[model samples]
Target: MADPDTLAPPRPRRWKRLRGGLSIQSKLLLMLLSVSLVSAVIVGAIGFTNGRQALQDSALDQLISIRELRAAEITETIDSVIRDASLQSRNLSAQTLSQTMNAAFDELQSDPLSEEQLETLETYYAEVFIPPLEESSETEYSDTAFIPDSNAGQRLQLGYTSRNLDLDEDYQELLAREDLGDGTAYSAAAAQYGDYLTHLVEEAGYEDALLLNLDGDVVYSAYKGPDLGTNVNTGPYRDTLFAQAYRDVTATNSVDAVEITDFEAWIPSLNHPTMWVVSPVGDDDGITGVMAFQLSLHRINNVMTGGEQWAEQGLGETGEVYLVGRDDLMRSNSRLLIEHPDTYAERAADGGTSPSIASRIAEIGGAVLLQPVTTRAISEAQAGRAGTMTGLDYLGGDSVIAYAPLHIEGLDWVINARIDTAEAFAPVVEFTRNVLLSLLGILLGVSLLSLVLAQAFTRPIHRLVGAVRQVAAGDLNVQVPGGARDEFGDLGNAFNDMASSLRVKQELIEEQQKENEKLLHTLMPESVANRYKKGDETISEAHENVSVVFAELLGFDDYARGLTAEQETSQLNTLMRGIDEAAAKAGVEKVRTLHGGYLASSGLVIPRVDNVRRSVEFARQAVEVLDRFNAQNGTSITLRAGIDTGTVTSGLVARTSLAYDLWGDAVNLAYRVRSVSGQPGIYVSQTVRDRTQEMVDYVEAGTVETQGQTETVWKVV
Candidate 1:
C-alpha cells in the first residue's frame, strides 16, 4: 500500500472550483448574455454589409442616370447651334445683307480712304486691339496684319467699329448708333441692316454674328466687334478656329452644309475661348458668303450644371455634370469656378494645374478650354466605354463618377456626372452608425433582462445575504421574511429568530454605553468626553484669548448652617441649577463647581470676540439667580465673580479619572482678583477693565499679585 503521508489529497478540478465560485444567478446571467451578444453581432454585421452594398449600387445608378440625361441635353444644345446657323444662313436678311454688303464694298473700292482715315484705323488696331491681345495670349500680334487691305473694309470698319470702340459690352449703345455721318455706300448698308443682325446676336445669345464674302472678307459684324471688316483668310486671326470654321463652310460649297469649329483662344476676343458655327448664305447661284455664329458657353453650362440648380436636379451639393473634349480639356464652365472661384483656383493648383492656368480660369470666369480633367473615367469614356466607377477627380479627391462618350455629330467629347464619395456614401455611413448603435442597444437590453431574470431566480438568497450583512455591520434590526416553504424559508425563519435575540442584547449594551457617556460628559466637556470614549489618552487645547470667570456665592455656607443636611443639599442643588441656566443664557461654559465657587469660561471651546463682555454679564446674571434662590429658600446669598481676558490653556487632566481644567495667566489672574474674605462684588483685572470700561462703569479695586506681577484690579458695582 502507498504511504498515506506521502500521498496528497485529491486536488479540486478547475471546472468544479469555478462552478463552486459562481452562483446559479451568475451562471445563468453569463450564459444568456453570451448568446444574446453573439447573435446581435452576427446579425448586425450581415445587415451592415448587405445594406452598404445596396446603398453603393443605388448611388452609382443615380449618377449614371444623371450622366445620361446631361449628355443628351448637351448634345441637343450643340445640335441646335448647328441648326440655328443653317436656318440663319437660309434667312433672306442674311442673303440680302451678303449681296448688299458685297455691292457696297465694290462701290467703296472707287472712293479711297484719306490718309487721316487710314491712320485712325492703324491707331485703333495698335492701341485698342493688339495690346490686350498680346497681354492675354502672351504673344505679339501685328496691327498691319489685322488692318483691312481694301478701302471699303477699312472705311466701313473705321466708321462703324473704331468710332464706337468704348461700347464693347454695351450692345444697346452700339445698336442705337444708326449712322456715322460718313458719306459712303458701306455706311448706308450698315445703317439699313445693323439692327436686324444685332437682334440676332443679342436675342440668340451669340457673342457676335458675322457675314463673310467669297473673298473671305468679314463684310458684316453684329455688335461691331474688332472682326467687323477683317478678312478671315488673310487677317492676323486667320489661323484661329473662327477662321477655320469659315474656310470649312466655304469649302463645303453646298447650301445645306454647316461647319462647327472647336474652341480656341481667339486673339480678337481678348483671347477668351471662342467657337463658331459657320454655314453658307446663297441665292440661285452657288454658296455666296458664310454666316458664322459665335457660340456662348452659357447654354452648354446651363445644360450640364442644370442652370446651377444642382440640388433640384437630384444632384446633391457636391454633385455636378461636366464635359471633357477629346483633348482632355474641359468644354464647359466649372461649377466650382462659378460658385467659389478662389476655392476652385486653390484646388486646381493643388491638383497639378499650373498657377497661371488656375488664375486664368478665375479671371475669365469660365473653364471652357482651360481647366484640364485627366482621370480614369475620362480615359475610359474617351475610349468609347460607358460605365460607372469610383476614382480620383480633378481636385485629387475620391469621387463616384458616371462616364460616357457623348454622341454629338461634330464634337468628340465625354460627359461625366460626379459627386464626392464622402457625400455619395453618406447614407451608407449613417446606416453603419445606426447598425452599431442598434447592436449596442440590443446587447444592453439583453444584459438588463438577463440580470433581472437571474436576480429573480436568486432573490431569496440575495435577501438572506443582505440581512446577514446588515447584522454583521452591527444593525441587529434586520429580519428575514420566512413566507415560502423551502430551505431558504427555513433559513429565514432561523435568521429572524437569531436577529431578534441579538437585537434584545444590543439594547442592553447601548444602554450601558449611554450611562458611561453621561458620566464622562459630567466630568468634562462633551467634546473631551467623546475623545475619551474613542480611547484618547490625553486631550489638551491652547486658547489664544479667553475670559475666565471665577464666581463665588458669598455667605452661602452661613445661610446653609440653619437648614437640615437634606434641606441644605436640596437647596444647594436648586441654586446650582439656577446658575447653570444663567450660564447657558449668557453663552458661557461652566467648567466645574468648587465647594462654594462656580468656575466658568468663554472663548475656551469656541472663540468669541465679546468673551470678556459675555463673562462679565454671566457674573451679573448669576447674582440675580442667587437673589431668586434666597427668596425661595428663606436664606441670604450673594454672587461675586472675577473676570479677566488673555491667553489660557484648557484641557483634560488625570489618566485614571479624566478631568478637564484651564490654567494660564488669565485663569490665575481671574482667581486672584476675586476676594475670599471681603465685600461681595464683581472684580476684574486691569486687562479686562480696559476692554470693558467703555461698556460698564468700574471703581478702582486693590491690586493682586499674579505671574510675579502686581496687576491693578477694578470692582464693578
Candidate 2:
C-alpha cells in the first residue's frame, strides 16, 4: 500500500447504468400464463365430472338390467320350487310329508350331516358327476364347473340368523291382523306352509332361500332354526319395510297382478352380501303369500365400473365413486370405501354432512316434502307422484347415481347402483392434468427463450438512443449504421445523413460568423453590403476624376428573403461578374460594390459608353440580372445600387473564404444615391448626375446630406 502523502486521490466512483433484461411484455406473459393455469384446473374438474357421469350412468343402467334379470331368474326358480312342492304335496298329503320331514329334521338336529356327506352322497351317484368330482385343483373344465341337477346337497332345516334379528315384534304385528285366525287354524295352516316351504327349500339348491309366513314369523331359516325371523334389518331394507308397514300387503286375487320387492342382506354371496328379492306367491286364486330368493347383485356392477377403472387405472392411488341412495346418502363399493382390509360390512362412515355432496343431498329432503320420490320408475309407479326414495349413492365427491325401478314385478323399489366417480373419470382427469402441466411447462420454457428474443428486438432501439445522446453531446463524427432493414433502420440511416449535413453546415456557419466578426471589427456595419467586395475592408475612399452613377431596383424586400443561401450568393456573384465584365468592356476601373451599387468612370479611365454612363449601365444591368436569376430559380432577388465618382479609400478586406474590397465617402454617397432611389430607376449625386445625363436619362427621389457633408446631396440620375 502507498503512503498517504504519496497516494493520489481515489478514483471517482462510477454509477451503474440500466441494461438489457425482461421488459413489460415478459411480465404480462407470466401473468397470462398463471391465469390460464388456474382456469384450466377448474375446467378440468368440470370436464371430468361430465365424463364420469356418462360412464357411470351407462354402467348403472346395465346394473339395473342385470338386477332385473337376476330378479326374474329368482322368480322363475321360486316359481319352480312352488310348482314342484305343490305337486309333491298333491301326490303325498302335506300332513304326511310334514311327519316325514319332521322325523328327518329331528335326526338332523341330533347329528347334522358330517363333512363326509359328500362321500356318502358320492357312492349314491352313477358317475354322472365324475367330471366335477375332483377338487378345485382340477381346473381343466373349471369354466364348465357348475353342478347339473343341483348336486351340492348340503341342507339345513332353517336359513339365515333370523332369530337374532328383531323378528318377534314383527311377528306380533303381523299376528295382530284381524283377517288371520286364532292359534289353532293359524298354526295348522302355518304347518302346511312350513312343510311346503321346507320341501321346496331342500329340493332346490338347499339353504339358499328364506321363508316368512303371512304372519311375518320367520318360520324356517338356514342359519337360525325353524321359528326364526326375516333378515330385513339394515337401513335400506328397514326403510323399504318401514314404508310398506301399516299398509295392506294382500296377495293379488288375479293371476295378472304380481308385487315384488328386493332387499340386500348381510348373507355372503361369493362371500359378500347379495340381493334377496321377494315376490308374492300368486296361485290361480291370487297371490297368497310372499316368496323370497337370493341373487348375486355384483355380476351387473362390473360393467358400470369401467369409467371408474379408466379414471384410476394408472393413478396408483386408491379412489372411490359415490352412488347415492334414493335417500341421497352417499356410499360406494370401491376399495376406497373399504373400512378394513377384510370386511365389506365395515366401511368408513362419513355420514351426511360432507361439503361436496351436502348441498345436493339437501335437495332430496326438499323434494320429498314437495312430493313423492321422483325416480323414473317410482314416478311411473305412482303415476307421476313425487315421493321420498332410497336409490343410488349420491355423495357429491366423485360419485354417480343411476336408478331404474323394477316394474315387471310391480314393486315400489328403485334399483340404485353407485360407484366411485373419480374411478369412473380417472383417465380423463389425469390426462387433462398432465396435458395442462405439459403445456404450462412448454410455455414457461418458451417464455425464458423469448427473453433473448426481446433483447434482439430492442437492440436497434438501444442503439438509436445511444446515437441520439451522442448527437446531443456534439459528437459530429458519431456514425450509426442501419440494421434489420425496417422503418427503424431507415430512420437510423436518415439520422446519420442528417447529422453529417448538420456538421458541414455548422462548420460553414462558423467560418461565416468568424469572418463577419473580423469584418465588423475592421469596417462599419451599417453598410452591410460592403463586407462582400475585397477592397472595401481598407479603402476609405478613392475617386477617378471620371464620373459615376447609381441606380436601384424596386420591391427588394419581398424578393431577397425568398432566395436560398446558395442562390442568393450565386446570383449576387453573377451580377457582380457582369459588372466586372462591363467595366472591362468600358475600359474603366468599376468599383463600389461594397454597397450593392456600381462605380465606373470615363476620362482618366477610358470608357466605351460614357464613363458615368458606364456606371449607370452596370448598375441597371446588375438589377436586371438579379431579377432574371430570381425568375429562373423560383427564388427572389432585388437590389438598390448606387454609383458615385469621388476620392475614397478602398482595398481588399482579407477573409479566409470571402471578399470585401472598398469603403469611404464616395461609397457612402453611392449608398445615399441608392437610399433616395424610386422604383425601377437609378439616381446619383450632382457630380455623376451632371456628367452621366449626356448618355442617359436620370431621376432624383430626394435630397439627403452625407456623413462628411459640405453640401446637400440629391438623387441625380
Candidate 3:
C-alpha cells in the first residue's frame, strides 16, 4: 500500500513498450488493414465452402429426380411388357389352343422323337438357322442400307447389327417349307398360328414371339427358325435363360404370372445379350403352355439413355441413367461407351480393369449389357439401399451416383443415374475461382483505403481488438468500450451481443451432446454407443460364446389382419414391451424387433457366465408373458422361440435407420429352429440344450428338419 504504483500488476510492460513505439495513426492503420484482410479471407473461404456445398446438394437433388424419373419410365416399360404378355397369354388360352397344347404334351411325354423327325430338326437348324448367323458374321451390309445416318436411327442400326443374326431369310424359308409334316397336334397348331404370331410381333414391336408346350418344345415361333420343335429342356438350349424361365413359369402354374429372364448372351442370337419375358398360357384346366417374347435392347437403351429427353431433362453432357441386375451386370448399353468408345476404353484400361472386360467394351462398340459393374452405388442399391454417393463408375472415373432398387417381380435390378463429378461441379469450381480472384482485388484496394481512414478510428478499434483476443481465448464475458456513437462503437456493441449468443449456444451444444449420448445408449450397447458418439464410422465386434434367441409370434399375422390400425399398434407395442421386460430381467439385450418377431442376444453386450441359461430363461418368461396377454385379451397369441449359443458378430447397420443387429450361423440356425418348431413354445437348439441342460429343464422335441439338416431340439418346461 505504501507504493501503490509498484503494487499494481507489472502492467504487461512489453506490450506497453511496443504500443508506445508506434504513433496512434500508425497503430490504427495496422489494425484496420489486419481487420480488412481477415474479413476478406474469411468471406472468401465461406463463399467457397457454402457455394461448393450448395452446388453439391443441388446436383444430388437433380440426380435423384432424374433417377426417379428414369426408374418410373423403366417400371412403366416393364409393366407394359408384362401387361402385353398377360394379354397375349389370355388370348392364347382359347380352348382350342389349350387342347392342342395338352395333346402335344401328351405325345411328347409318351414317345421320344423318331430318328426321321430328329434328323429333320437337325437339318433345319444347320441349313435354315445357322446359315443367316454365319452369313451376317462374314458379310457386311451396305452402309446406306443398314447403318442409318441419323443418331437415333444409328443407335437402332447398331443394336440390330450387334444381334448378328439376320433371320429374315430363315423366316422366309421356314414359311415356304411345306415338306412332309409331323402328324402331332403341335405341328398343326404351329402351322395355323404362325401367321398370327408374326402379325402380333410386327404390331407390338416385339423382335419375335414363341409358343411353347409344357414339355419345353417350341410349338411355334413368329420367325419359325431352328427353335421351333427344339426341346429347350433337353436340347442344346437346355441351360439357357429362356429354358430356365420356361421351367419357372410352368412350375408356378399361375395363369396370370409372368417370368422375365435376366439379360444373357443368347447363342441363338449369335451370342448377343438377350432378355425373354414369358407368361403362362392356360384355360381353366391348368397351365398348358407358355408364350415368350424376345425384347429389343434398342428400346431399353433409348429409355435408359434419355433418348429424347436428355437435354430437356437437364442431363448434361456427362449424365446418364442405366440399369444393373443383382449380379451387377449392366442390363442396358452404357451411354459413355455408346457415344465415346475410345475414351471409355482408355479410362477402363487406366482404371486397371481386367483386359477381358476392356476388350469386351470395345468389341460391343460401347454396348454394355452383360458387362459386370463393381461400383459402390450398384452394390449398395442391390443391398436394398437407395441414396446418392460419390464414387467410381463403370467407366472407372469419379462420378456422382443416385440409385434405387427396381421392384419388378422375378427380377432383382437397380436403376442408377450418374454424372461425372468434374462436370457436375464445374460451375461451383469456376465460381470459387472467380470469387477468390475478385476477393484478392477487393482486398488490395481496401488495404489502401483502410490506411487513409486509420487516424479517425483508432481508440475504440484498439479496445475492440483487445476484447476479441480475450474472447478468442475462451473468455466470452469481455466487452469492448462503446462510449463513442460511431461505426466503431456500433461494432463494439455487436461484438458484445455475439459473445453472449456464443456462450448460450455453447451451453446448448453441451446439453444436446449429453442428450444424444443418452439416446444412443438406448439404441445400442453403451460401449458401442460411446464409439459411435466418438465418430466411429463402423461399430462392430465379434464375441465368443454368446447366445442368440429368435422369437416369432405364431398366428400374429392372421390376428393382426382382424385388428384396427390403432389396435394393432397398441397390441404390438404391449407385446414388445412385455418381451423387452422379460429379456431385461434375464440380463439379455433385445437387439431388434421385426414384424411378428423379436431377436435378442446374451453375453455379447455384457458377458455373463451363464448366457445360454439366461437366454433360455428369457424365452420361457417371454412365452409366459404372451400366454398371460392371450388370456387377458381373449386372444390365441403364442410365442415360438429358438435359442442357440455360439460365436456371433453384432453391429450397427445403416447410417440413417441405425439398427443394432447380430449376424452369424448361430443366429440363422436359431431362426430356422424357431420356424421348424411347428407348435409354439420355447424351442432350444441342441447347442442351447447342451449348454444349459443343468440349469434348465427340457424335454426332447424330436429331430426337426432345419436348414437342410436334422437337429434335435428341446422344449423348456
| Tens-digit lDDT string for candidate 3 (10-109) | 5344334434344546656777787888988998888888888998899899999999988888889988998888887877434356456456444544
Q: Which ten residues in a row have the lowest lDDT in candidate 1?
A: 11-20
- Model 1 CA RMSD to the hidden true structure, in angstroms: 31.2
Question: Which has the greatest TM-score?
Answer: 1
* Candidate with more favorable, higher TM-score: 1 or 2: 1
RMSD of 2: 42.6
Q: Compute each candidate's TM-score over C-alphas.
A: 0.58, 0.28, 0.55
Better of 1 and 3 by TM-score: 1
TM-score of 1: 0.58
What is the C-alpha lDDT profile of model 2 across 1-717, one tens digit per residue?
679855644322111122234444553344444445566656655765676567545555544444444335434544554454334333334334334333433333333344465343333221332232232112233322221111111223111221123323343232222112323332344444444544444445433444443433333333232223332332112344321420134333332332333332231221123334444434454443344544323332332233346234322343222222344222223433222333221222232233322332232211111112223433432342312222433222334333443333422334333345555445556666776676566656655655555533424356668988998999877766543234454567677888899899999999998897786544433343354444444433343554544444444435557778786677567766766676566555654454344544443324233556666666666656766766886655465566676655544454444343455566667767666635444556777767656766655466767765543344434
- Please give, for residues 280-303, the per-residue lDDT of candidate 1 as tens digits: 998546777888888886777788
- Could you tell me how far off, in angstroms, the CA of residue 194 lies in candidate 3 after the best superposition? 1.6
Deviation in Å, model 1, residue 427 alpha carbon: 1.7
**Per-candidate RMSD, Å:** 31.2, 42.6, 18.2
Q: What is the lDDT of residue 528 in candidate 2?
A: 39
- Per-candidate Cα lDDT values, in order, are 0.82, 0.43, 0.75
Clashing residue pairs for model 1: none
Could you arrange the candidates by TM-score from highest to lowest? 1, 3, 2
